[model samples]
Target: MIRTATPADVPVIHTLIRELAAYEKASEEARADEKQLREALFGERPAAFAHLAVDDESGEPVGFALWFLNFSTWRGVHGIYLEDLYVRPEARGGGHGRALLTELARICVERGYERLEWSVLNWNRPAIGFYESLGARPQDEWTVYRLTDGALAALGSGR
Candidate 1:
């Protein structure tokens, strides 16, 4: 029971995001606002999309995957970059995570995308093993960098 998420699901999605952060031991960092989520997903131009997985019997959402498209200039093709994927603790081992990823892979293949990629915390051994078992290899040679907080503002101001 997996389906694309609608704007109505924003609250549930936000709750799940908090849950994910808590699971990752970064609950304080989960500061997503529901209104902003709605605007992002259902605005004039959406920035991202989400898919929800629900319980077969109860019809209650059990997990979600948020993703967006990315362009690979070298490959001259588009790719899917998964931003977040999370399943409830009680729903662990139920195949929801794999199903979500499988759907994303299908989307990539069907659309002729070059890749489906996401990042995982190095300390999450279980998640790393799960992704490896799915034939996802880490891009160990590439280093990730970010510009945020004061640095991002300073750059924006050309200071």
Candidate 2:
């Protein structure tokens, strides 16, 4: 079962985030604590949204999808930008990941959004294959770039 995340699920979400970080071989980058996550997800004005995929038998959250809305100037509609989608290793192959993605797609269709999009690591063959199987074609013409940490701060300083 998939449901929208509530404040009570912050800890589980945080733990799952760490687990996903470890799986991606970037454990050190998973720095946000539950408090930060709670504020981000359930704050007075939320910056993002999350959904949880729960185990049918145990009724425990096994996976999650974190996303936020993005406005496309060309489409003139808000689309969901999925930031992360993960399922515990032990809980994978049970359709939890697909369920989470399906829920996101459903939200887009119901709201008349033009797209539901996410990025996958180029080296992750399994994930690439899975996305391809779902008819998610890669936007090879565009390159993703970001300035974070010092570069971000420096640029924002208007120097």
Candidate 3:
């Protein structure tokens, strides 16, 4: 069963995030804590949104999709940029990932948005295949870039 996440789901969401980092072989990079998630998701001004996939019987969370909105100047519309999507390893084949993505796509269509996008690591063939099966095509012409840590700090501080 898929449902919108509540503030009560923050702990489980944080755990899932760490689990996802570990699965991606970069556990050390998962630095977010429950407090940050609470503020970001449910604070006075929310910055992001999440949806949870729960066990139909137990109502325990199995997966989640965390996303935020980005405006495309060319399209003159807002689109969802999914930051993370994960289903517990034990629940992998049960269609939770697809459900999560489907919900996001539904949101895009309902809101008249032009895109729902996310990135998958180049080495994750299984995820790539799953996305392809869902009719999502890669933007191969584009290369992603990031400025983080020292580079981000230097640029922000004009050092």
Estimate the overall C-alpha local distance difference test score of candidate 1. Answer: 0.94
Off by over 4 Å in 2: none
Give the per-residue lDDT of model 3 (tens digit) for 1-159: 899999999999999999999999999989999999999999999999999999888889999999999999999999999999999989999989999999999999999989999999999999999999999999999999999899999999999
> Using lDDT as the measure, which candidate wins?
3
lDDT of 1 by residue, 1-159 (tens): 789999889999999999999999999878879988998889999999999999898999999999999999999999999999999989979999999999999999999998999999999998999999999999999988999789999999999
TM-scores for all candidates? 0.97, 0.97, 0.98
Off by over 4 Å in 1: none
The candidate scoring highest on TM-score is 3
Per-candidate alpha-carbon RMSD to the true structure: 0.9, 0.9, 0.7
Regions more than 4 Å wrong, model 3: none
Backbone clash pairs in model 1 (N, Cα, C under 3 Å; residues 3+ apart or in different chains), count: 0
Which window of ten consecutive residues has the lowest lDDT sum in model 1? 28-37
